[model samples]
Target: MDRDKEYRDACNQWLADCMLIYHNQVEKIRKKRLAAATEALTLCIKKQKKCVNETIKETIDFDTSYANKPSSVQMNVPKKVLEDLSFHSYIRMSATQLENLVSLTGPEMQKNNCFKKSIGVAQGLLLTLKFLAAGDSIYTVSCQYSIDCETIENIISTACKAIWNQLVLNVMPSDLSKNRWLKMAQEFEEKWDFPHCIGAIDAVHIVMQPSSNESPSKQKSNERNSIVLLAICDANFIFTFVDMGTYGCNGEIFRASQIGCAFENNDMNLPKPSPLNENDTENFPYVLVGDEAFPLKTYLLRPYPQKDCIEVSRLNFNCRLIRAQKTIETCLGILSSRWQIFSKTINMDVDKTMKIVQACVCLHNWLRLSDLSGNSCVRYMTTELVDQKVGDVFVAGSCRKSSERSGAFKDISCVGSNVGSRKAIQIRDSYLHYFNSNETLTRG
Candidate 1:
């Protein structure tokens, strides 16, 4: 009887403790809910007060203005139909939208109070875009906007650098992973039947004013003098790598060798060439397609000699390469066509010129990402013509085998066979057909 009584007493004590814990938890929850409700009510009251204050201020201002006005005064004025102003028609962006984009770069551009006050972000962006879209010189742009030349230049340079560093580099598709590069290679192969192509390689001559300090030996002939820009572009016509220090008139072969050496030496952070797989048909590893300017290496493919094959085979190869190489050519065309700075002889120092080129390329990539081109047909034509030119150049004589040269030349002389006769005619006819076609139809 005594043991039973003790057990009952312990059970009662346990029940009492459980009730106490539950009561504490309920109290905590209630307090939390009450605090949240108070915060929400306070915010609502604040907002209501602000609205009321604004309404009272507006009412007072209106009353004061009405009290100062003369009630009986009237004057006859000529009626005018004010049509919507077209002055802003060419401006594709509003001041607010441009300011938003510029603000996206970061606080550095926004913090410059003098800059912000002098030129609104919208006006600055419109000026730069006008320079790009219309290919106008800085002088011309300055005249149109009634801005000083130095001010215009400074604005363009600052804005371009900001856009390049923040928007272009930060947002560009990276080629860091091998998996992504391999996927790109596969896409190139599928589209153009060009195997293992990560990108297209080419060179362009950027005309520059004669350097006053250049020695006689450094200058090219009087007819042509400029700096050469060697570049590699990806499928989207975006430059993956660029080399701009070479002088004009350097042989394409020499430039290719330099670039190859740079890759071999790890001078640039280029992907290292891998050994060929056992099953690989072409022993060439890490290849780039180029015109005759490049040598006949395992890593590069040029066109067959003009005399060797039927026209159909040459035409086919040319067409394929043209489609592949179009990216680089289009890159150059866009650079020259959109940026008038490159269209004429650039007078800036070499370092500044290179920076401008890089800035332009970065801008092009950014614009492409934004899909800002309104007219699809015009864009297509611009890209297509560039590809066709690359194809024609590659098909003509770029890919001749070194071993076959001596023997083939002897045989061609003896046989008196027409060189590259088959493919040349087809390409010529196709080019003419393209040239003669209506622009609208061609774009379609």
Candidate 2:
């Protein structure tokens, strides 16, 4: 009986000890998991703090000194010249304002070392604008600014890419509502007496350096050979669409046709047309006005042949076409004359050239917006025209008496009468006026 009791007590004690051991082991595991979790959380917090600190540092750095410094270690452009060239007028943004824009554009340019390093982002951007505005050779720009050609190229590429990808893409309003487009169409009708016109269409050549022998076959086409740029200008003279990559020597009519097809195929961002009917035909139909190079389709209108029996009618159509198409010429003229970079052959690869072109377009829009927002004098001028005398016989036959013209022309007579109810008469008068004005002036 005594041995049995002793053995039983020992077994109970052993069981108790094992249970305690097991509990201790479980507690130890719990502690280890807690420690590991705490360590992981602590490490994450440190990483987050480091990131916050770095961001704050960057913000502070940009806010304090980014705008005042030059883009490179050495200041290549003279301080005075840089100051003078800096857009500082009512039409130009201040340094701080430009810096904010740079900050907004910084992320897109972060991959570029030229943008990431020594130069102020604004200064780098300014250099590129100067290049575009002056149309100077890269070598000449380099010599004038005292920066290496490579650096100038880098700055221009980075700045242009970022501006195009960010500002132009985001800010350019694309609301092509029928009402808006129709309003533009109506403006053409009222101002230039162009019936059922949607917008004025024309192509301008932006000269580029000859393509390399190694250039891809697709890029070596006739239009791409010399770089012809096609653009459709709104009534306000703003370029709504620009298509490049055609050969320079390609006829404007051919290129305009391609663009029209592209618009039909939805290649360009043209708004879709609604169904057509006779009553709405004169108002709702979208049409493109071009010179003799383009065919006469219902959607596309061209001047009547000068040699046709309807010579007066042709003259009228041409005058209206010129009045509307003048916008494209004005836009191109401003681009080439105001921004020098476009007037001369561009040295960069085609891809870079495209970005630069886009950037300039965006910049032009920006300037226009700025100009409109304020009452600045010296708004950019339009294309010049010289007045000349038209043969009286041609004018007399083509121009109908105001009383003889149809009702539609009379209903819009208030606007048309200023020039004249007859299209041929208006054109002849404009030509005469152009010729008499200045010998150097060229018709738009």
Candidate 3:
């Protein structure tokens, strides 16, 4: 009996030992696997980093030989840039203008010491202007400017934010008093012959993604992820108001815009409805002119339908409406043609891209106010479109001839209905009658 009990205890001890050994072996295997997995993950991340920057490398060979070469920056770069007339093709601003911009934005652009020493205010501004004006790839700009890619991007973002903060109020003031609007209305009437017109409204599509971001199926199609720039321009081709960061047709985007929402709520601070002339019986409200894609409203006017143009009065109205709408088109052309950034697909993050856009908008207004076009300004302001004889005679403006914009946001045809309220139609008829009348005057 004693021997039998001892044998059972020995067997139990052996079983326990085996179980312990098994667990120990399992732990060793698991530790190896964990280390291997962590190493693999680290390698994967490194590979992704390289791939991300190299996706478009085949198209343009970047000289990363930058590190081995002498420093890519120079103190005289701004001066050289200003002296090179050809450089204007890359950055459209003049020396004095660029310097003035530096003065306004230099404080904001100032930076503290970091990974790489911060470039000077002027150099950083030059890099930003060149990148924005030409839409050069980040790597390309970095190599050309002798700056790091991340540094350049930060510089651009800072400069743009500075521009917006400094100039948005003075250039494109949203809270313009009634007096300012009256002045804008005066300019429209004198230039476009569309009395009581404050501005021309339109929407432009700016592609926010590169072709690589789209799936293969979508890449082949016309579809791309994009945002709309719903802009209103005065007779002087200055952006008075701009709302963006939406994706849709013009009508949908317009409905979602600030001006459109204000119009819907009847809360905008527009001039009250008044007679077209002292002798006129009906009172006409001040209005904005847009293409047929926009709904005709009491406060907004679009051209008559093609079928309705059978009558001479309707034809004349359409002609005049189209003539005023040219301001929107001209402004878009000038914006795109001069800046050149809107001409290409933007590959950056959406937030940064938006800041750049705001900066560009402010710059456009500044340039117009400063009269950067010099002698060309006189030619640009020359009378282009004339409908004194209606559709029977017309001439394209010098702006249209000079400003064949590259790849700026394009004007799109609206698929939705634009036929508006009875009151809106009545407003259109009143304008139509006023335009056809021989008594119509150019003075607002």
Candidate with best lDDT = 3
**What tens-digit string does per-residue lDDT give for candidate 3 at 60-165?**
1111222112233542242233344554555666555666777787666564231126566656677778877777888887787676788877878887888898
Model 3 spans > 4 angstroms off: 1-78, 81-90, 111-116, 211-224, 372-408, 441-444
Worst 10 residues of 2 by lDDT: 407-416
lDDT of each: 0.50, 0.55, 0.71
Distance from true location, Cα of 301 in model 2, Å? 1.3
Across 1-444, the per-residue lDDT of candidate 2 in tens digits comes to: 999999999999999999999999999999999999999977974453343432232221232244453344544432221133234432244444455567766666656777556566756666776677666678986777677788878888888888777766543554466676778777776655554567766554444555565567745543453444556666655666666555433433343446656654655343455423343322233666655544454455555557662544445446666666655555555555445565445777677787888887777666565556563333432223111237653222111221121211111101001111354344333333332334313322
TM-score result, candidate 2: 0.60
Model 3: how far is 140 from its true place, Å? Answer: 2.2
Please give each candidate's TM-score.
Answer: 0.53, 0.60, 0.73
- As a TM-score, model 3 comes out at 0.73
The parts of candidate 2 lying over 4 Å away from their true place are 1-72, 76-104, 170-175, 211-224, 247-258, 266-284, 375-444
RMSD of every prediction? 23.2, 17.5, 14.5
Write candidate 1's Cα lDDT for 1-444 as tens digits: 999999999999999999999999999999999999999977974453343432322211111211222322121111111121221223223223334455564344444442354454434655665664455677887677666777777666666666666665454543345665666566666655565667787665555556678767655642234445667776666666666555423443233345656653545443444423344342234456555454444444445555753666455565666667766666666555445455455654555556566667666665454443552212312333242346447432221221122210111111111233444444333433332336413332
